[model samples]
Target: MMKIDIPTMRAQMAEGDKKRDTGLTEPTTITAIKELSYGPHGIENTFDIYYPVGTTTCLPTIVSIHGGGFFYGDKELYRFYTMYLASQGFTVVNFNYRLAPVHQYPAPLEDTNALMNWLLIHGKEHYVDTEQLFLVGDSAGGQLAEQYATLTSNPHYAGLMDFAIADVQFKAVGLNCGAYFIGQTGAINQDFPFYFGETLPEQTAQQFPVESFITTDFPPAFITTATHDFLKDVAEPLATILRSKGVEAEFHLYENPDGKELHHVFHLDQRNPIGKQCNEETLDFFRKFL
Candidate 1:
């Protein structure tokens, strides 16, 4: 298993963000409203909305959940990429949840539930078509996305979390290099305590298995990963399971025969050519629901 030094990994991510900051550009035209609080969690529960500039037309909305091994990442780190999606003519809600090892499992998931409720109530003020909502997540956020998607449609799953799913219905779900499994203990994600809290890994897995929730009524999904991603192996099984359950699912593995390896959640960087293509393809998949 590959052990991660959280401190060093976080510093490296922040440094990368600094470098990417200077090269960031809007796709064509986009505007952002920053730091709007959605719930009572102070700044951690805030969200940013990005949409086309000077347009009041209701657009398909993409609610983005970011990835950082479940303990790191916020809307600020994801602004540029979300803005690019907005420029593509979708209203994007990029949000932050309280991090783990401090906030723990269901807290973040609860925050996700609350945010969706908030959007459903307040979305029209921003010209968001709540009926055409799509959920997008990367890496750890993918796990959150899958959970949220399932919770919204599965009463049993929603009962496990003790929160009713929001009234807003999802048009589709888009997962990028998602970490979808929590069953294995030796999967290089040793910080399960941050997510599982006092619960055992096996119990946590039983409670939140993405595969178990994949029924015919489940929404369509677009799942993407790269050959070099550490989480690559988990992607195919998820797509296969979704299909087996009679749900529409598409899985893409980005491979570069030229040997340029793309790591996990590469799409979040946006500078990677393959990542850019993957982002465009994911957005295209969302369009099918429209």
Candidate 2:
């Protein structure tokens, strides 16, 4: 496969995250099913499902998309955090999607579709109540989650995609430190090929934004960011747009703790008290529609 030529920034970022999660330990209260493949990409397409150890009945499910600026991250990186979510009473699916430069636009989206289908087939056997499904993503994963949710809800946008839409109803979505408005930023003009694998025509570009494709059918959302997150500016605008379209939108901007700015995806760090607080609030938001 001819991969796109990109910088080593992804590697550097991955190292940083590994360091961030180094000392954290997952709680023993949850049960985990690991390394199940949903697509043909071997380990890259594999997933892990987490739920409370003694769960007897199906529970509300949260399918989480991992962050890495579209080029990095995996189920293992989210292992502890997803376990924490499970401990709090939910079945959580965390998985790896094909990354960019190696696998371009729509690959992760398609993988997301495959994962959903996989759940539809295997979910009941594993305590996933697909009927009460929800989506969550951070950073680049946020973009993928938002886009996938839009496709599931909006027929007009779903028609433009290459694959059949995944048949799943999302109760809500959590967009954490994510970019929701694409192409509105000038970077899209040049970064298109790097991520999407082609230069889009002006009209197509205009039609491709996550915001533009969102409809009233879009799932209710919990959008969040910290004072220092680069994507902090995106959450409010996305909530505004969703509200304009009659979708329920709850946006939260976290203030710094002890006057220290919180970086992007700070909620992923289980050690951070503020991150835990944010997760609890996000869970409360998801529970509302349940």
lDDT of each: 0.82, 0.86
Give the lowest summed-lDDT range of ten residues in model 2: 1-10
Candidate 2, pairs of clashing residues: none
Native RMSD of candidate 2 (Å):
2.7
- Compose the digit string of candidate 1's lDDT tens values, residues 1-290: 33456678789978877776677765558878888999998999999888998878889999999898877889888888889888898999999998876787777788988998898888888878898999999889998888788878777766666567788679999988888866544432355664556445554556745557656777899999898999999899889988998889999999776988878877877777787898899989989889
lDDT digits (tens) for residues 1-290 of candidate 2: 22433467767777887888998777778888888889899999999989998999999999999988777778898888788888889999999989876887778999999999999998998899999999999999898889999999988888887789889989999999997677775545354465665565554454467778888999999999999999888889999999999999998998765888888999988888889999999899999988
Global lDDT of model 2: 0.86
Off by over 4 Å in 2: 1-7, 185-189, 201-207
Relative to the true structure, candidate 1 reaches a TM of 0.92
**Which candidate wins on lDDT?**
2
Candidate 1 regions off by >4 Å?
Answer: 1-5, 26-28, 184-191, 198-206
